[model samples]
Target: MVDADQTFVIVGGGLAGAKAAETLRAEGFRGRVILISDERDHPYERPPLSKGYLLGAADRDSALVHEAAWYAAHDIELHLGQTVDALDTAGRTVRLGDDGTLVHYDKLLLATGAEPRRLDVPGTGLAGVHHLRRFAHAERLKGVLAALGRDNGHLLIAGAGWIGLEVAAAGRHYGAEVTVVEPAPTPLHGVLGPELGNVFAELHREHGVRFQFGAKLTEIVGQDGLVLAARTEDGEEHPAHAVLAAIGAAPRTALAEAAGLELAPREQGGGIAVDASLRTSDPHVFAAGDVAAFPHPLFGVRLRVEHWANALNGGPAAARAMLGQEVVHDRVPYFFSDQYDLGMEYSGWAPPGAYDQVVIRGDAGKREFIAFWMKDGRVLAGMNVNVWDVTPAIQDLIRGGATVDPDALSDPRVPLDALVP
Candidate 1:
């Protein structure tokens, strides 16, 4: 059933695409593997772009998925600085942007990934306004942070999402005055809800970061082609030397859309709609990472995850599925964030209105606690803040779908494993 004559062409050189290529070889496909990326740099992980790398605590090479020599050694055709301009689903071919070259493939994986959502406010093109989504963007922002720190300048950030907060911490680490503008009542309101979101707000406040909640940035005022201040809808103007638009990211679904693949609606976290095996509507085409919205059997929702863990695991899963292996990507959505002395890992999906109550264990004052979002006594999601080695147990409880007592869930003496059955 396996032959070297077959070729697999993976579009997008991010973690998902790169890992898929590696999995194909590891699975003993012995087929030609080609990976194409629009970015000039080799496939790299994105977490470091905002965390360690932004703070100058880690080097650029640490974020790379593989060494430069690894591709050639593994017989992977690495094509960097090239974009797939078109996808011809019927013909099983893709057109490269650099030239009118058409590459044919027996199977195709679209890991095109996502792009940073740009701010529609004026003065976005002004110098000192930045968005961190790529290695190059991080590289530029690193220098900007250093310069701002040296000058003791002010950094104004829009949106209090993960990127915004992480960069706020990084800016403070660089000794820059950091201020965040958010329309929500608290940080991460959409993800963690106001209850736990307040915890992050307090954490940042203690670290000398300013938060302007219940406000939206109306304009970015600039002078001499440089950011001078940011105006809020509340009629407040904050002096700013630099601005970061960390609102969020939008999936790159243009290629998949053009190919006539089924896509999930924008309201349901827009992405290429894929089955449990990560196969797109077109059987020969598959998708993974931030761009694929697959039905999560555990959560009972069509989920599209944009965190590092998704890309890290989604690629290999999609690869095995392409090889005709039974693959069900039902991994609980998971993500981690480190800001100042606080490190938190969140597992499962628990957006606001979805959970009845949030039960917390440990001390919120000490910033060490595990918060569980429950629906009718069933744990829908769990977030461990400054807690370690309990993710597996928390995931088990969620998968078990058993009613857990709030008192036991909140008791530190009770082992999380015991709550599963």
Candidate 2:
């Protein structure tokens, strides 16, 4: 029922953009589909970059979203190593960065994603300094870790966030000495709070990873264009053959900003502001993945999720919306992580101060427990550590928005489904 002359354009080459393109084709859209990416490689999932791939357990090809031949077979105009420099919202066109080629689009999806926040301290440009955001960064870090392992070198990590902690585990697995410098009192204090964050601290500490808590890296000392050590605010100098700045990532919103798109404020986890259907201020444009901040009907707050699950699911939702489907992107926020022997899956959003009292079910010492963040006797978020197959039940409890006794919630004997109204 659609015009074959119409075209749908996607601006990113990451998982979200790739999945959007796939969804457009799957939704029976026969119009011209143009997918542009700045990276030369095919779109790939990023979880393995810091997980299996960095640990040398998964191969590079395992990360690809689809086979190289799939794009051509599906008749997708795959433009790799291409950047969109200018977005002409008035003209419904985008200008290519390399050759200034202008491409028209009936509808545009902005999945520009995010970039790692660089460490601003001096000596960051020295050799052996690293930031793991892209495939190439992971490749280089893998080599650096291997060399450090063989040569007995030290690795100084700047933050205690997920990336820093995961890379710390990988470095230890490689037999390299690892030290993490964190500005918070405990690792992941912002996300898990100090209570649960201590669990991760102990996990890493058991594996020989040292933590310098409540300190920031003021300088990265180097000599002869190579890293030598990192000096923190506490005046402690840590010897380092390599340094990783795993502080965080900022959304890539330059293209959207230049196009006069509405952006969420800095406090709302800043990104391109989109509605429940992922439609931007301009009706002809939409957004998804890390670059899109949309209001969540469930959480009742505007959220910009940087996790893999958001990208994996948001892309297709935006695609369907673009194709005139009635879509509401209100899926509960979800993410997972693996470090050393501990693995965890978290659902819903319950940052510190948002919920009161965290109730734990099972034994924390054994690392097999489900922690629930509750407010007014209702579950706001749930994280199952070393627990299996209860994500559905946990999510149901959150979605049902029912209040239950804290004693029953903390009792393993009680079934999670029964708690949901």
Task: lDDT for model 1, please.
Answer: 0.93
Q: Give candidate 1 misplaced runs (Cα > 4 Å).
A: none
Instruction: Residues 51-170, candidate 2: write the lDDT tens digits.
Output: 999999999999999999999999999999999999999999999999999999999999999999999999989988999989999999999999999999999999999999999999
lDDT measured at residue 363 in model 1 versus the true structure, 0 to 100: 94
For model 2, which pairs clash?
none
Write down the TM-score of every candidate.
Answer: 0.99, 0.99
- Per residue, candidate 1 scores C-alpha lDDT tens digits across 1-421 of 5688999999999999999999999999998999999999999999999999999889989989999999999999999999898999999999998887999999999999999899997889998899999988998998888888999999999999999999999999999999999999999999999889989999999999999999988899998999999999989999999999999999999999988999999977999999999999999999999999999987788999999899989999999998999999988899999999999999999999899999999998898899999999999999999999999999999999989999999999999988888
What would you estimate as the lDDT of candidate 2? 0.95
Task: Note the Cα lDDT for every prediction shown.
Answer: 0.93, 0.95
Which candidate leads in lDDT?
A: 2
TM-score for candidate 2, please give it. 0.99
